[model samples]
Target chain A: MKIVTCIKQTFDTEAKIVVGGDGQISDEGVNMILNPYDEYAVEEAIKTKEKDGGEVVVVTVGGDKAQEALRYSLAMGADRAVLINDPALEKADSHAVSVALAKLLSDKEAGYDVIFAGKEAVDDGAAQVPSRLAAKLDLALANVVVAVELADGKATVTREIDGGTEELEMALPALISAQKGLNEVRYPSLPGIMKAKRKPLDVVSLADLGLSAEDVASKVEMVSAELPPARKAGQKLTGEVDEVVAKLVELLKNEAKVI
Target chain B: MSIVVCAEQRDGKLSKVTFEALSEGKRLAAASGETLKALVIGSGVAACADELKKYGADEIAVADNEALAAYTTETYAAVLAAYIAQESPALVLMGHSTVGRELAARAAGIADCGLVSDCVAIESADGDYLFKHPVYAGKAIGTFKISGATRLATLRPNVFAIEESDGAGAVVDFAPEIPAAKVTVKAVNKVSGDRPELTEADIICSGGRGLGGPEGFKLIEDLADSLGAAVGSSRAAVDAGWREHAAQVGQTGKVVSPNLYIASGISGAIQHLAGMGTSKYIVGINKDGEANIFNVADYGIEGDLNKIIPALVEKLKEA
Candidate 1:
């Protein structure tokens, strides 16, 4: 059994996001970490390998800084890491990113029995890359998986839907995106961190993957950006709970007209 | 030319977001000089066609199949892909609900087209469409322009107004040969709640970690019941095991734009605000005046939720 996990780096959830003067995102003085959800994917991939005696590979697409995310995955227990980085690929949309990933994974050297990824990157929240990559690879895919059991060339997956849960069975050579509450992620030990520094971290380009500039062209273009408008302050009702409740009732009936 | 809208239904009932999608589809099709068509795929959903027709759809296409009774990425994608491949509509529309989140990209991927998800607004300029959506957890808005043979977009629920109408239109039977789903849905445990869905509710009352424990939601639920509103919770409440994930309203949770949103004991994170900030009216109740929830709240009541909620529930019950 061979497993490959897709990962990304994003701003820490607590980081204050600010738009620069040029309408581009400014992450100055902010901490960057592997996307929180991807941690679940990496943990699941490592755990599966620990149980089934297989190799785990972590893959990422971004600039040089993204290699940190790859190393973090390696530190967590992945055997090797692959970085698909180029200046031109920085602003690529989800579609282009999927194309590049599919191209890279299709390599005979990158043969994988199963693939895992976070349900969505916390930054873009697109939730499209892994599914689209599965489509491109022509593999079965299940997103937002909470539990997975792989055996006999098949995977029984449990996922959350609108109201409840659904148990799905898919053959191997499948793709799954990890949702939260999947598992508790473990921190990298000092020995693991030291070993990760010596792990095989291969950086590849689009040309290396047999992809052209035209093949990975972004379909969605960012036209503009701005901070969301500030919400106006609402009137505060003081006094006892009864008074506040009385006032709220009157306001809902007369002003808001909701009740 | 036509603009295709995927109408979502569950258990033989149409989702409100489905109507919202059709409304936007009508506007976009009119702007682009394209006909609006609604496509529903499920078991026994032929009756849903009339609702789409009344909401301004020019044509309603139903792919009634037992295999599609519940959503699986493969079956829905294949059926929708088959329809879009044959029709080649200028634009494809769906609601950015759980089903849409799973179905939209797969269909677009199979159709070999581009998609923008969770769009709050769509603008047409010279027949080209530009979509506005939130990124970076709703702290900033990004406008996207997609260029492809066919365009796909999922509209955020409650962002678009549903058009009023009383006219039923034509229905066309679309029998596509759906392939066997690679993934099988064994069972579905539907939520047992009489309150409206969080995404489609007119009024929402959400609680947060300030309630201290799971019991805090009791007050929240009581107020919600009295006002005929849906119950919501911040991610903190959900993560703390105070509420179900389905009731979570935040960046990772369901985005809601209800007519009235009441936040109790919630210290708003940007992620939570991103989900509900678009709401028409926001009321915040927290002991701390500095909670970020107050920043976006239209009405701020400084008090303890434990007392305020019960008192409010009593007042409503009396009224």
Candidate 2:
């Protein structure tokens, strides 16, 4: 089984999200981090390869600097890296990006039994790619997958819904968007990082995927940026623990009405 | 032009969030001087059309197919996108639900519009809609204008009150131009358990690092169980391995706006506050009076939650 994992690069969670004059995110001088959710995807892909004896390819749709994110993958343990490096694909919305990804996978004729991605991207947190890719490629998809296993030409997965999580059994060659706690993300060992540098990293362009700039133009654009208002700082009560607890109960019942 | 609101239904009943979307549609519709319409889709979900009409919809589009019998992104997006195109509503209001987020992202792509997910506030100023959403895991908020004639957005549940009205409405069975077969649902596997819906739970009890470990959290769980509330945790609690990230309510985790929120040992970092600052009532339990959580909480108890929680739970049982 060949597994393809989609990893996205986002500003580190701690970075100050400076909205530049153009209303786009200012990435200059900010520490970059892989989307937290994608760690589970990478982990799942490596685990899949370990279980079913297949190669795992880590791919992304980002700028040239995004190669560092791929390097992080190498440090951890992905077998290969494919960066769709073209000015055309940058800032492509989930829809256009998914179309480009589907076309890329098909053009390569990459035989894979399963494709994995995080439940959603961390930057926009749109959570769109996995399902949209499934629609374009016409494959089965399960979003919010917690448990996944492949066997005998089929894959069994468990995911979440409004009520709760349910188990599912479907045939192979499907897409799944993963969530956290599915597995523990592993760290890159010294040897893993060393080997990652020598590992094959394929760079694909939109032209090579047989796609055009127009096909990947974002339909929606960000107009402006502003911050949320701060909550009014409240007063704190002082007393013994018992008095504080008693006073707290009175406030909740009388003022907050939570009881 | 009229507006369309998608009312989500589950277990053969309309989700309370349906009212929230309708409430927003009601506001936007009234502002634009247009009637509000509702587009509803589910398996065996058409019976809910009449109830939706009373909420302010002038017309309801009911699409019931076995394929849609379950909530899959493929089936629901195609179904919703086709309906939005047919109606050409000025605004589309949807809940920021698990299904709503997935469906909204796809629909925005199909309709060629932008979506502001997990929004806390939507304001109409100078004939443009301004949306407020939390960023940086919840320490700060970002407001932006969606530049499009057809504005589509998903509202965070419970942030805005679900508007109510005595509007008269009717059901209209309309077929979309696109065939349902245009999309395929290869498989669906949902998690099934007795967990309450996190976003909509009126009362949420969350634990944090102060709880020590998984065993210590059982007391909080017991309190949550007695209150019949959803369970949540702070980033420290999740990092400490006391709870799952799904159960985390903070900036990096799920943002929630329940009516009543209880935090034990949560110091109320900006990220944690961003996720739940919109909660109407908050109770904090910690030993520090200067904890940031007290800044937003309606009430505070500077004490050990381990001793305070069992008593609170017992008090509730007596009441």
Candidate 3:
């Protein structure tokens, strides 16, 4: 069995982010890391390989800085890595990115038995890529998969639904997008980190994939970003506990009318 | 110009968001100088057509198909696309719920247009419609202009005010040339949550990691029970495994616009604010006065939630 995982790099959430004078987002010396959701995808991919005895490949479309994200996946125990990097791949929207990936995956080597990705990226929160990719690849796709049992040449998938979950069986060569709490993430040991550097990583530029920068970008561009207006802090309520409670009840019943 | 509003109904009854979308569509139509139209689909569900008219729809397009009895991507999209292409409405509007977000892109895909999902406020500006979307979760705001002539947008429910009437307008039966059997629902599994439906709740009580554990939600539930409010959670609570993601309120979770939002033990992260920041009124209960939740809170209570919430719940019961 062969599995492929899609990953991306995002601002390290722990870092303090700031908006500069030019209205651009600057992390103010904060570090960058692989998206946490994608980490779950990587972990699930590795576990699937361990269960079915297959090779796991981590694919990332990012910049020179993204190499570190690829390295992180390798450190966590992927068998191979592929970087679709180029100056042109920047700011690719969900649709174009899925197209570029589907073209590359289809026209490239190694027929994959399964593909996995996170439900959505933290930055954009556009949960369209996985479904779009599956549509483009013409693969039997399951979006937002929470659990899976790959056996008997078919994968029984458990998907989250309104107030509950559903179970379905799909044949091999399927696509699945993972969500958090699906599996426990493993930390890379010292030896695993060392072995990561020697792991096989194939770096391919966007040009090599026969796609130009425009093919992967949104026809729409984000010219500027700004913050929402903050509401005035509510009048501070102070007194003994009962008094404050009385004030709150008055507000809810009279002023706010929430109750 | 004509506005196409997707009327979302459940079990042959109209969802509140349906009226919200209808209200928004009416507003958009009046703004754009157009007539408001509606599209209804389902199995044995012709009764909802008359109710939709009272909400402001002038012309209602009915597609009675057994396939649409339940929402399946293929069935809904195919029928919706057919209606959209035929009518060529100036804009299409749907409730900015989870199902709305999921279908927005697919609808845009079929229409070959761009979509601005999760829009809080929308209006026409400079001969183009401007969509106000929150960026950086709820920490920021940005305006988007869709160059597409047939604009698509999903508005957050409960944010828009709903107007009711006794007027029932013209109902036209236009059979969508599509078979429902083609799109198999395959299977549906749902969890039965004890909490009131978060999206439909008029008053919401959400807890954060400050609550300490899953047990803290019990106090939240107690308060909510007293107030007849839905229980929700911050991402910290959801990520900490104290609550389900469905109950999460933030940029990554469901965006809510309840009349009243109460945050207990939540420090108010930007991501969490993005989800419920648009509520009509927000009350923050936290020990830290400097907590960001206070920035948008209409009432700030600086205290320990464990001690304060119980007292508040008791007060509500007494009231």
For all predictions, the C-alpha RMSD in Å is 1.8, 3.2, 3.4
Q: In candidate 3, how many clashes are counted?
A: 5
Q: What order do you get sorting by DockQ, best first?
A: 1, 3, 2
Per-model TM against the reference: 0.96, 0.89, 0.87
How well is each residue in B193-247 modelled by candidate 2, as lDDT tens digits? 4657888888899988878788878888888888788888998989887776678
- Candidate 3 CAPRI classification by DockQ: acceptable
lDDT of 3 at A119: 72
Q: What share of the true interface contacts does each candidate keep?
A: 0.67, 0.35, 0.33
Indicate the residue-level lDDT of B4 in model 1.
91
- Model 1 lDDT tens row, B1-319: 7889998888888888889988888787768888888899999998898777788887889999888887788788889899999889888999887778768888877777889888999987887899988887777888888997688999888889898553346799999998887877777766736888788899999999888899888888888898889999999988887887778888777778999999999998878987898898898999998888777776788877877888888888899
**Pairs of residues clashing in candidate 3:** A163-B191, A164-B190, A164-B191, A228-B140, A228-B141
lDDT of each: 0.86, 0.76, 0.76
lDDT score of residue A118 within candidate 2: 90
lDDT of 1 at B180: 82
- Superposition error at B243 for model 3 (Å): 3.0
Candidate 1 regions off by >4 Å? A27-29, B166-168
lDDT of 3 by residue, B8-114 (tens): 66568777777888888887776777788888777777899978878778899888877677765545666777888888877788876545655555556555555
lDDT of 3 at B303: 80
User: C-alpha displacement of A70 in model 2, angstroms?
Assistant: 1.1
